[model samples]
Target: MSLPLPAPVSTYFEISNGSDIAQVTRCFTDDALVVDEGQAYRGHAAIQSWQRDAQKKFAYSVEPVGLSRNGDRLTVTASVVGSFPGSPVQLYHVFDLAGDRIRSLEIG
Candidate 1:
């Protein structure tokens, strides 16, 4: 599905839950940047490649719990269930939105 640009928190939840690399890429601007852990991915090409690698390495479900906005920044806290088993892990995503697209995303 083609989502609204910049997308809502639920949109992120859906894309992450589905682990849809294409959908995730569509949520960002052409020159967006994503920082996860200590790695940084820039632009749509790099982001798509990163997501593909991540999907293959990690099997998990991402459920968004809450969303908060401060100016152009939006933060989401989500519960993640890894395929390895055990309790669900918590992940925090901080998004910097520009116009209708995501300019930057920091995930931890």
Candidate 2:
């Protein structure tokens, strides 16, 4: 069964399946921050750059296997298979939403 995700979170995963960088950025707030691999991407410009860099570096796909909430954060546990060092890895995506958009996300 698929977990029920919020609008922006749902959109994030949906767009992530493809290479639509603009759609991915649209799921976040104007001042959103995204952290992945110890690098922080602030705002759409930085986020776009991050996405582009990742796309250029690896060919990968992510499948969200679980979801849970903690306080104001929603955490999605996903299985990611990519061209990186670890072909398959379980990642934690913690999202903080503001209204219909995501305010922040930390992926590990």
Best by TM-score: 2
Residue-wise lDDT of candidate 1 within 1-108, one digit each (tens)? 232324534555666665466765557888888998799999978877887776678787777676778899988877788775554878889999886678888998
lDDT of 2 at 3: 81
TM-score for each of the candidates: 0.81, 0.92
Write model 2 residue lDDT over 19-105, tens digit each, in one string: 488886668998899999999999988887888888788988888999999866999998889889978999999999888899999
Write down the lDDT of every candidate, Cα atoms only: 0.74, 0.86
Model 1, C-alpha of 8: deviation from truth (Å): 5.4
Give each model's clash number.
0, 0
At residue 81, give the lDDT of candidate 1.
88
Structure candidate 1, residue pairs in collision: none
